[model samples]
Target: MIMTKELWEGNAAIAEAAICAGVEAFFGYPITPQTEVLEHFSKRLPEEGRVFLQAESEVASINMVYGAACAGARVMTSSSSPGVSLMQEGISYIACSEVPAVVTNIMRGGPGLGNVQPAQGDYFQAVKSAGHGDYHMIALAASSVQEAIDLMVLAFDLADKYRTVVIFIADGAIGQMMEPAEMPPLRPVRPPEERVAWALTGAKGREHNIITSLYLGAENLEQVNLRLQAKLKKIAANEVRWQEYSTEDADFLLVAFGTVGRICQTVVREARAQGMKVGLVRPITLWPFPSARIAELAGRVKGILTVEMNAGQMVEDVRLAVEGACPVRFYGRMGGVIPLPDDILPELDKLDAGVASGREVQS
Candidate 1:
């Protein structure tokens, strides 16, 4: 099959990629930067005779996804920050139930009703667990439109492979921006006979299948939690994905993800041209973060600078990964403000000076 690159907006690309991945249904509410995802699916899915629902609220949308997932259908939902928060309870239910589902969070700013601008403020909520209880969803962060498209496809596969929730978190910038990208070829929808063994298709020929997050017995709930933990360990061991640039011989490193990660590449290039050795570690998977790689890089670099579009959320993870091997500093622009190369270079300079002067600087 021939593949051609075409200009694509990030939100629309996410919907298109889901369709290409054979998403059987999409249940979503309209939210900025991500409303396009729902709109795209609304038009495309119905045309293809697939489900496209505009639920009254994020609460309704997530539960719809949960029901479809239990039926072993490829299901998804999209929302921004506040809308996602509303779905937390449903998300936890889906996680505990161990059904496969895809959730797309085109993140915006805020602890409350923040603006519909690009921000990584949801980092902690997403990676630490989007809802209550001791459960986690596979979280993937995309830095570009192309990566957003690719990760949407990967999210579905990962969700099915793990039989768990997968959250694809892309900042509002990516959702709003447009770039040239290649959409994956369409995949045929899995027939009922091909659904997973655990699906609730029917119990005619076999024992009934019960899918629920509620384990009323104390021992039963403990066992369920243990199984979830084991699954997370497996995911961490096998799914820690990240990209490194210019680290062969570097005095300093830039650690970031999503839009900030993309911007740091420019900082690395400019810093190199000015005779400063710099490198970057852009994490693709936020949950099973690239901690091991960052630790190794910490051992060799003079210092690490973590840049983010939030008030330094991911920096905490970087600090843990560094483990005092070297000074880890954070620089961030919060409340929907994006940090450009100009905004970040001075922070790197400060980290360099602190390292040179045997001092530590914190963000």
Candidate 2:
């Protein structure tokens, strides 16, 4: 299959990816930095006889997704920081109910109603707890328009494989930035009988399959939690994905993900040009974080610097990975600010200076 590469905004690539991946329904409401996703689905889905609804609100939208998912449909929703917050309760329910749905968060700055500009402030809210629950979802981060498209397909597959919600998270910069990307051929829609074994279809010859998060009895609830925990473990073991750049032999390591990881890539090259041994480890799966890789690098590198668009969220995870094997420092720019190589180089320099002076690196 020949895929013609064309220029596309990040949001457009994501929307197109879902369409090509055979998503039958989209339940979304508009929010800045992510509104284009809803706009695209609204215009394009009708041409394919698919469903796209601009629900009254995010709350209603997520619930709509839940209904679609239970019926064995490929359903999805897109939202920004505040909007995703509202969708969490619904998301948690989806996870516990074992529904396969693809969701996207084109994250932005947040506290209450934070600005709509690009920021990675939703890191903890997404990776740590997509919603409040004992379950884990397959959380994938995309750093570029192309990766976003690729992961959009993978997110749906993983969702279906595990019968769970999968989140494709990218910061606002990637959502709005324009880049050339290739879209794979449209996938054939799954037949109703073959889509899922336990869809909420009416009882016929087989026993009816019930879908709910509530397991009222104590023993039954504990058993459900145990099964969920086992699934999470399997996902972590098999799905931890990351990319290592120039870390073969380096004195310093830079850890980042999403758009910030892309920035750190340039910093790595520039630092390498200046005869500095700098490398980067970019996590693609944030929930089943590449903890083992970070632990391995911690022993090899003299220090690790975590650069992010938030004050410092992923840094906590990095520190946990390092376990004091080496120092883990943080540098960030919040409220939709994008960090540049210049902004990050100083942090690396401080690590070197700290080493030379035998002093602790100031974050």
- Please name the candidate that would achieve the greatest lDDT relative to the true structure: 1
State the lDDT of candidate 1 residue by residue for 1-363, as single tens digits: 999999999999999999999999999999897999999998999998899989999999999999999999999999999999999999999999999999999999897988988999999889998688998889999999999999999999999999989999999999999999999999999986788889899997899999999988999999999999999999999998898899999899999999999999999999999899999999999999999999999999999999998887899999999898999999999888999999889898999888888887442
lDDT of 1: 0.93
Worst 10 residues of 1 by lDDT: 354-363
Clashing residue pairs in all predictions, respectively, total 0, 0
Show where candidate 1 strays beyond 4 Å. Answer: 361-363
List model 2 lDDT by residue over 171-214, tens digit each: 89999999999998999877677757688877888898899999
Q: Tell how far residue 179 is off in model 2, in angstroms.
A: 0.4
**Best-performing candidate as measured by TM-score:** 1
TM-scores for candidates 1 onward, in order: 0.98, 0.98
Q: Which residue pairs show collisions in model 2?
A: none
Summed over model 1, clashes come to 0
